[model samples]
Target: MDASSGNSAFNNSVAPLEGFDKDMLSSTLSQTQALLEHFNISDIEKILNMSSRTVSVMTQCYCSGTLREILLSYKSVHGYFSLVVCVFGTLANVLNVAVLTRKEMASAPINRLLTALAIADMLVMLEYVPYACYAYLVLPGEINMPYNWAVFVLFHCHFTQVLHTISIGLTLVLAVWRYIAIRFPQRSHILCSDRRCNVAIGIGYILPLIVCIPSYFTFKIQATVVFENDEMIVLHHVGLSRMAKEDDELLYYVNFWIYGIIIKLLPCVVLTVISCWLIKALYKANRRKQALKGYTNCNSASLLPSEKRAVSKSDRRTDRTTKMLVAVLLLFLITEFPQGILSLLSVILGRCFFRTCYYLFGEIMDILALLNGAINFILYCSMSRQFRTTFALLFKPRMLAKWSTPASQTDVQTTYV
Candidate 1:
């Protein structure tokens, strides 16, 4: 019954009927009537391809009432695929949280952020579940949502912009924590402890809303017409607020540029620099340890059979966590790189040829973002010894007795399995 958790069947069945108004709705209804008349989904696609302004106008005037609205919305196999992806991502996130929220889980500053992120991803999943269900059942022309183009754009895309901004920022927060832990291990306890870490996450989530509020007030979206000859598609323009005219489209692109540089590129640089420093320091420490061993055979070609022993799984995972963060960053760059380029192109190049590609391109990035959330559990298990032990105790309380083994005796990664 918690509002934060499940997506009930009742909500799904009645959502279309709940929000419609006697005078406030008609857009989808009209489309549905037209769709029923045509009985062909291709017609809806062709209509969808038209300008945002055209679609807005067409929907605004759609005759009120009835079902079987736009068939094109749910008719595609792609829509089905999107729904499945969203469902899988949501369920994975839920499982991840359930695994982590146990009473026995060790409370660390680092784990607090992990918990916060899991909660955020949970919300992300919650948002997408309804979206997926809508895609499955409510075609664009059939979806009974009202047609206030201004309100719709403000509510959905703007909100997503805020979340996207937060997502990028959280990654950097983790990167900074990693950098500090590795490069300045002496100070790690003070800077990365539970209290400070919780505050850092609290502030990180808060800052996004404060920064993005201007966009909410200054931005306005309405259906606009883009015509080349007789072909026109309804376009959504993010411009100045109601009755205001400003070229903030450039600002939107700039916002993205700022986000990319500050959140993604800068953290990547900081982490890379810190990681290299850690490697050099570790090398020096290893050299000192060898020197103290009185085994100073600098010129000797050595074959130590002891060094070839297979590493314990926990050590393997700890090292792998460092590498994984870097690798995931690279993967993120690869996946999002195209979207950023094309997004800039949409604003700077102003090419009509590329506009239609935006949604398709963006959904690709969304999938990567979703994937990013999905893999974080593996990252935690690799990086944090505490997470592995606690995760084990979640589903197996009997294992709690086994965890009492002295640190030297414990096999961290093996405990999880």
Candidate 2:
């Protein structure tokens, strides 16, 4: 087939040259040719002949012929690693949803958001399990079966994006709600009410589903014929969509601004700013608590026993909840901020950056996100006494009885966050 015909066959895959100026494309190709001069010219030409897109050219030239090998190596390692993590994460998130939704825990508005976050995370892990098995564990030669794995691949791409985007949006809402609670405790009930929280969570899911509609059209399946071992075989794979191929500006906008900015970088930046503000609020609250403690010590005779106890308990609970939430937000920042920066860099530096760095490191980013999804269970168990108590009461009644005192049980019964 000619170059244009071959390109038509795979219109749903990544096509890096769709939006570039002809002169820029020529300069990029020259640079790519010069970079690959050490390799066999015939071999490079043969690969380019298969798909003469910018992605193909850059993979060969910018990656120095190592991208495929690196992908194979990481796929083997992360396939098993990711499977284990996803399974553990899936189960952990299930437990999180269960525990967070219990009557004892459900009263808190924050727990409701946590429950939503856990559900979204669990779906992410569950969806990844089969993908890891098929993409990573299966032998390469056996991958070209009659089954339409490409469709599932397309579904996985959009499915994960939607769920993760929901997770990010919910997290932002969670942070904002916490900040309002901390900053305006008296009006928190009206501001962060259960009805409002549920509405926010609904928007979190709906907005991402809508924003990602454009992404679903960016890829499609294409079948191509090849001769191997003197036999003609048809191989099906994902390619750029017809719209993506025909509209360079749309492709660039979707990949760079929508994926990088709207999906990744914008939320991450907002989360970081909110986290800083939370930390400052926590510091101020701590100072106020210390000052109140000193004043209480000086005026011990003036205050009633009930009032003093109430004041102390309220202060402790608020401080603990704020600190725990800060930890959760920080974990999110640590895992997602690097990805945002890398995504931005990929767009800014063009296809070479994507092929040389971003694509090669994609698996690492996936594993990081999986870890983030999984590790929240550990955080809640470690940081929240109330969560531990509820979990024990539900799953280990005997242990709960063994460990509990009346005062502790009373404390645990009340909503913490």
Evaluate all candidate structures by whole-model CA lDDT and list the values in order.
Answer: 0.47, 0.69
Residue-level lDDT of model 2, residues 1-417, one tens digit each, is 001110001111222222324343333443543423322221232334334565456666444566657653664477789889999999999999989998878988899999999999999889889877866555232524333676776667777888888888988998899889977889999999989988998998899888877667666766655444456555455556788667564664465557677777788888888899989988898787777877779998898998988877887778778888889899988877777776677667765665455555566677888898899999999888789878877787574477666776686776485
In model 1, where do residues sit more than 4 Å from their true spots? 1-78, 99-105, 135-137, 140-145, 148-153, 218-244, 247-321, 327-331, 351-354, 378-386, 397-417
lDDT of 1 by residue, 33-147 (tens): 4653432222333244454565455443322223223222323443455556656656666655675555444344554555666666656655655554543345334523333
Candidates' TM-scores?
Answer: 0.61, 0.83
> Which candidate number has the best TM-score?
2
State the TM-score for model 1: 0.61
Cα lDDT, model 2, residue 14: 25
